[model samples]
Target: MGVWLVLAGLNGAMAIGFAAWGSHGVEGEAARWVGLGSQFQLLHAVALLALARFCAKRRRLFRPAAGLMVVGVALFSGSLYLKALGISLPIPMVTPLGGISLMASWLLLALAGWLACDHARV
Candidate 1:
């Protein structure tokens, strides 16, 4: 729980900073990268918070989701950032894998929620 909270807060802060830089400090393609990075950071922050509050009991998967979110943010956003710098990297293609991971995390979360609801009904 503590870790999740910290991650959520940290990621949120990072996202805000990146977004600010993108909007004000950088120009051209770099701005686009920062923008996307900021967006993913925000999403990662939110997901971590949700896991801390709603899925802490399911520690097995919940923790991994948090990590995946962080990684996905790095991969997806990182790629865009690199590209914006005009440096060609093979990593942008990995963005889809991150997307897949994110999708899995959401699906797992939904399943956990459903299980909880079903148990509550019993």
Candidate 2:
């Protein structure tokens, strides 16, 4: 949880940098990529912050959700950042995989909440 919080803070900072660069330094497609990546990274950074807090109470489920979110942000936003800078990965499907990972993380988070409510009732 501590690690996740630190990572979330750092990611938030980087996302801001990306957004700044995208808005002021770049143009055309690169700007769009940076803008989109920054948006996702920033949003996920905030989510991770909350998840890190929630993980303290529900380590079993929130931990994995946090992990998936970390990986998802790295792959998805990282790929976009790289693309904006004209670097291409050998793997063509990285962005899509990242999106899938992010979706999976959200589903897991929801499941954790639902299960916790069920346990509370019982």
Candidate 3:
């Protein structure tokens, strides 16, 4: 929850930065990457918040789902940010990891819902 809030806050800042100072800063490959990445992060933030609400009563479910979300964000969004920023790093394989994390997150969410319902009857 706190993590989501922080990322969401960061996204808000980045979104504003891109909309404002990024005009000249974001250009070429890096620009497009940043722009798209920022949008993705923003959307992810919203989704994460919503998911948190849904997972409120299911802490066990929330744990894995939240973990996946964080991993996914770090991989998927994090990659794009670095790529866009033209950062000199070992061209990390962050995007794929993020994608896998996202898929796991979605699947876990479903599983969590089922588990929650099952436990209700137990």
Candidate 3 local lDDT, 1-122, one digit each (tens):
56655655665565566544345777777777777666666676676777766655557777678668767877786787777766755755668878888889889888876876857567
Candidate 1 Cα deviation (angstroms), residue 115? 2.2
Q: Mind sharing the TM-score for model 2? A: 0.94
- Across 26-91, the per-residue lDDT of candidate 1 in tens digits comes to 898789878987898798788889888754675566676667666777777766666666778754
Candidate 2 regions exceeding 4 Å error are 119-122
RMSD over all Cα atoms, model 1 = 2.6
Worst 10 contiguous positions by lDDT, candidate 1: 54-63
Number of colliding residue pairs in each model: 0, 0, 0
TM-score of each: 0.79, 0.94, 0.72
Model 2, position 108: C-alpha lDDT score: 92
Evaluate model 2: give its lDDT: 0.93
State which candidate, 1 or 3, has the greater TM-score.
1
- By the lDDT metric, which is better: model 2 or model 3? 2
RMSD of candidate 2 to the truth, in angstroms, is: 1.8
